[model samples]
Target: MDTTTHVAQTERRRTSPPAGSAGPSAGADPRRGPKRLSPRMRKLTLLIHVIAAVSWLGLDVGLLTLSVTGRISDDPETIRAAYVAMDVFGDVLLIPVALFTLVTGVLLGMGTRWGLLRYHWVLTKLVLTLVAFTATVAALRPGLEQAARDALRTPPEVGAAASDVLVAPCVALALYTFMTVLSVYKPWGMTRFARERLGRPGAHGAARGK
Candidate 1:
């Protein structure tokens, strides 16, 4: 072959994509973002998350009922028993369930396209969950313990501790319900971070490149 022909053929081979390939932009673009969870794994994590959240709500309801009973009942024995049960439930069930819910929720947020802070609803949920978890550890459990101690006293005087137990659970229940609604409706649009990221040059192309 002529030297010029040989150089031209080599140049074509170097420039051309391999057979049946669509060149560099053909598949998922690594620049777009990190990989998400597999569909099945995501579903499994979601299931666990739902169960944990429901369980936490249920525990809160149970605690609220006990608190009301302890506060309203005239019988000293009944009040003591109710308060003791509340303490046990708080220590053995409530804290663990709240932690589980938080962990699973964070996992789902980070593992899926929704992202932890990419959307307003998701960010709100994360903030609320953190608040709830902190309250459970810092306030609710201590209140329950104080109420239990007051109930067990010789005179069985719960005093202001009774109100604390009742109020904490009421607030927690409200927060959980609101968070659940947020999950269902997913109101509000993307967060500022998401909006800014999407606005950057080649963002759409990178997304489509995936």
Candidate 2:
């Protein structure tokens, strides 16, 4: 009888789940869903992303100021200085900061529930960032360089490139401001792809129900 009882206990132990283990259904599948960052890492990434974005915005504002000064100032030295400063900012700081902002934003989207294509706001921001980055590299930088060259000429004049240098920053500033508001408000709901991928109602649905 004791041997029979011992055998039964052994079988029970073999059949039972290990202590503290969750059932298969209780946790997410590692193979599925977006990869998540640890809470600390997420916070760090968010901080960096915000800093980079703000820096980009600040740079835009500075460029706008310089462009305006270069365009309107009668003093040759002042105009030359403004355009030179604009060129320097564009050459040394602008692209790197924009790149950092874009990369960090992408990382945050991929590493969190927000996801790259999950929501309208995120998608819009991504598109805007890409457009701004491309314009800065392709159009804005060249315009700044040309303006600086024009300013450095014997007469130090504002030329065709002046309009581009001024307008680009204004557009970029507006876009960045809009994107900032979007981040705060997050107005739109999830995309159709996200809804289908999640296989359930998303945050908007949950909020409405609440």
Give the winner by TM-score: 2
True-vs-predicted CA distance for residue 152, candidate 1, Å: 0.5
The global Cα lDDT (0 to 1) of model 2 is 0.90
Best by lDDT: 2
User: How close to the true structure is residue 42 of candidate 2, measured as C-alpha lDDT?
Assistant: 97
* All models, RMSD in angstroms: 5.3, 5.6
Per-residue C-alpha lDDT of model 1 across residues 1-210, encoded as one tens digit per residue: 999999999999999988988655788543235548888999998999999999998988998899899878999999999999999998899888998999999999898778888888999999999999998899888988999999999879878888988998899889988998998899876666775775655554555567
- Model 2: ten consecutive residues of lowest lDDT: 26-35
Candidate 2 to native Cα RMSD, angstroms: 5.6
Tens-digit lDDT track of model 2 for 108-206: 999987888888899999999999999999999999999999999989979899988999999998999999999999977777777776666464577
TM-score of 2: 0.81
The ten-residue window of minimal lDDT in model 1 covers 26-35
Model 1 segments more than 4 A misplaced: 1-35, 200-210
Residue 64 in candidate 1, Cα distance off native in Å:
0.6
